[model samples]
Structures are given as structure tokens and as C-alpha cells.
Target: MSRRSTRAARPAGAARPAGCPCGLPEPYDACCGRFHAGAAAPTAEALMRSRYSAFVQANAAYLLRTWHPRTRPDRLDLGPGTRWTGLEILAVRDGSAFHTTGTVTFRASFRGGSLHERSRFERVDGAWAYLDGEFPD
Candidate 1:
């Protein structure tokens, strides 16, 4: 069997906590929540943060929507037992209002360990979408 690391989905109308899972100082409603609620992220970093928040919440729809069409999978399967703990952005390249493409390196921690990747992003229809990533050696 092939193991897949995909995003999950949050339950309907769940009460938000004091802060965003993205680790931003702002509250959930003010930070990544806005992106989850339909607002477009302004930069690649913003999109990356929001995506991390989505993973933490198991919001598969949001993750898929922000994925580049060329790379998006037909379905997501976030490990049912996985528990996301936090996110930390390590680096970034271009990906902004002025740039069509950009890259963000980050580490996403969970119960046991963490995932590290340098993700790529590009604009599609004027909105940033996740393209792909590479694991550093």
C-alpha cells in the first residue's frame, strides 16, 4: 500500500481557538481563517501559511483549491490519526504581487516529528497556487 500525506477537513462550524494554527500573532479569524473563508492570499508566504493552517485543521478543500491544477491530486487523504502541531517558515524566493512565481521553505511539525520542504508557487488567474516542492538534502 502507498502512504499518502494529504490534507483533511475540519468539522462544520467548529469554534476557533485563541490563535491561528499558522503560528501568526493574529487570531484565527484574522489570520489564516480569512484565506480559509474565501479571501485570496496576497503573497506566496501568505498562501503557504494559510495552507499550513489548513493542514492543521484538516481542511482538504482549501488545500486542493490553492494547489496548482497541474499538480493537484483528484482526492486528498490526510492521515486520520495525524495531529499537526505547528508551522515555521524557513525561507522564500519571489512569489509576491509583482512576481508570477515564488518558493517557500518551511517545516510542519506534528505529534512525532516534522516535515520540511521548499515549496513552489505560481499565479493562476491572478491567485497564488501551490505548484510543487523539493526536499533538501
Candidate 2:
């Protein structure tokens, strides 16, 4: 495969921590990469966190495709100075429908500083995807 296709076939393998927030029962590459590479994610929260990681790593294509159409943005400009500190999965439940959602509360740090939010997700066509989120002070 040519360099371009190889890059497209396999998204750059950034230094993902030993395990991923997805809880997909494997490392980020083996787990989420499967989904990022066209396979399916196991649950809503998994897909959401993986998308978060994708953003942190600057994977634009993955971010857009996984975004729900109703709320999907025309473009994803993640910008600069945004560093992900850590992830704490608060809870995941009630994912039995296309609109069924779940929440993942996590602490993220960046140049602007740090904040915590409960990100939301929804499943569509047997694939879980990120929607939007809410931040609480």
C-alpha cells in the first residue's frame, strides 16, 4: 500500500495510554481502532470516549463520521492548547434504542485550564456515537 493509503488504512497510532476509556475489553488500538477503521463500537460510552481521544489526537475524519447527523457539525475545529488530562467514566446505561443515551463524566486539562463535564452519547444503527455534553461548576 502507498503511504497515503497506508495512512488512511491505519490512523496514526498515537501514544494511547495502556487502556482506553471505551471499556471495550482491549487496548485503544485493537479496540477503538476497529471501530475507527470501520468496525462497530460495543457501546455508547465507548464510542464517545474514543471520539474524545480522536479529537485529542487530531483525527478529523473519524470525528466527523461518528458524529450524529442531527447535531453533527459541518467541520470540527478542535483548535490548540487543549490537553486531555484524564477520563473517569461516571456511568453507562439505557442504550437500547437509536436515541437511547448515556453519560460519561470526566476531568480534562488544557492550556486554558481544567474542567469536568458529563458528555452524552447516542446509538444509531447498531453503532454508538457522540452527541453533545454539559459542563457543571
Candidate 3:
């Protein structure tokens, strides 16, 4: 089976709660949902948060689409049992609406553990795209 299929299935068209999975105070529709529906994220931090939400929802298409094409993987597998729990934005640098490049450091908690990484983003075609990340020691 495809790794994507191994993930827990969410009910199709299920109504999501007002709060977004990315730990943002705003509703899903007002936050990451708009990004998933084709609106470009205004800043790198917004893209990072929305990417976290996509992972939580197992939305691989959104993940791939938002990834920088040059570094994007041939395919993605949301491997089984990795339940994303929460996100905490630690810092952001340069990646504003006017900046072409930026970085976001965040802590993302999951069922088994948490990941702390500084992710890099760049604007491609006037939209923010995830480039890569580094795990802090």
C-alpha cells in the first residue's frame, strides 16, 4: 500500500473545528484552510504553520505543492503512527512579504516525540515555498 494510504483516514468532507490544527488561535477556514484552497501564504511563518497543518491532516498534495520544486521529493509518505500533536513557533528571520527569503524555527510535537528545526523558505513565483530544514542539536 502507498505510504499515504497507511495514514489514518479522515472522513471525507468532515467539518473541522473553528481552531486550526497548527495551534493557531484562528479558525481552520480562516487560517491554513485558505492556503490549502490555493491562496498563497503571506509570509514564511504562515507557510510553515500551514505545512504543519497539512501534515496533521495527511494532505500530501498540499505538502508537495508548497515544497520548492528543486528540492521537493519525488514522492512523500506520511508513514504510519506519526500523529502530530502541536506546534510552537520559536523564531522567524527575514521572511516577510517583501523579503525573498526567510527562515522559521519551530517545535512540532507528535505522539512519539517532538522535532525542533530551523526551516528555510524562499519565494518562488511570488509565493512562499518550503526549501529545507535543519535539526538543531
Candidate 4:
């Protein structure tokens, strides 16, 4: 006999989650949504997570706003068909509130493949901003 437990039926009053695309246990609104709404991310990892969520939500304005002005592009094109699937934070360094600069190493998976980037971040105007990145082999 199989020991697998069957699923329990939910009450009609129960709300279902579409799930936060950022891979966090919390819902989108509680997690990355605050950052998209203009709240500054407290850490470099937080900014990186919110940035990943932004890509998933296609909030180009938020992405642009969090990017450093010196390195920010003139325009952003998210493309038509690329779908981001998941985000995995690999490493972090010096990105705390006490530091003015930091880096986050992460893997962002998509429909076809994944992007591995060591993204640099710096404080601009007292807020953390994406500065640039390097692709490591």
C-alpha cells in the first residue's frame, strides 16, 4: 500500500495564491511588491530579489528606477517571449545597510536557460541601486 497522503479539500472561504514569482515563501505583496512601490530595499540581496521580481512582473519603470544612473541604459526592452522561471541567490558581499557598495551573485532561470551574474550595487542618493555585473565562467 502507498503511504502517500491525499490532498485535503479546502474551505470555499480559503484564498488561493498564484504565488510570488520571486521564489520566496511570502506572497508578492509582502515580499518584493513593497520595493516596486518605491520602498528602498534594505540590503543588496533584497534589491537583487526585488529586481528579479520586477523582471518577472515586467515592471520596467521599477527596474529603471532602481538602476544606477551612471550605468543605467537609455531604455530597457524586456522582449516579447522570454519568461523568467526562477531566481537563486548564490552569494553576497558588503551589501548591508552599513556599506555603501555590494555585490550579489545569482542565477536567474528562464524558459530556455539561466543567467549567472555577479551584480554590483552601490548606494545612490541613500538608496541601493544596480551598478553593473560580470559574467563568471
RMSD versus native structure for model 4: 7.9
lDDT of 1 by residue, 66-135 (tens): 9999999999999889999978787878887999999998888999999999899999999999999999
Q: Clash number for every model?
A: 2, 0, 0, 0
Candidates' C-alpha lDDT? 0.88, 0.65, 0.88, 0.86
Superposition error at 70 for model 3 (Å): 1.0
| Tens digit of per-residue lDDT, candidate 4, span 1-137 | 11111234668999654656777768888889988987889988889999999898888999999999999998899966889987877788889989999998888999999999999999998999999999997
Which pairs clash inside model 2?
Answer: none
TM-score of each: 0.86, 0.69, 0.86, 0.85
Q: Predict model 2's lDDT versus the native.
A: 0.65
How close to the true structure is residue 62 of candidate 2, measured as C-alpha lDDT? 93
The pairs that clash in candidate 1 are 8-58, 9-58
* Per-residue lDDT of candidate 3, residues 21-56 (tens digit): 887668899999999999999999999999999999
Candidate 4 clashes: the total is 0
Candidate 3 residue pairs in clash (backbone atoms < 3 Å)? none
Worst 10 residues of 3 by lDDT: 1-10
| Model 1, runs deviating above 4 Å | 1-17
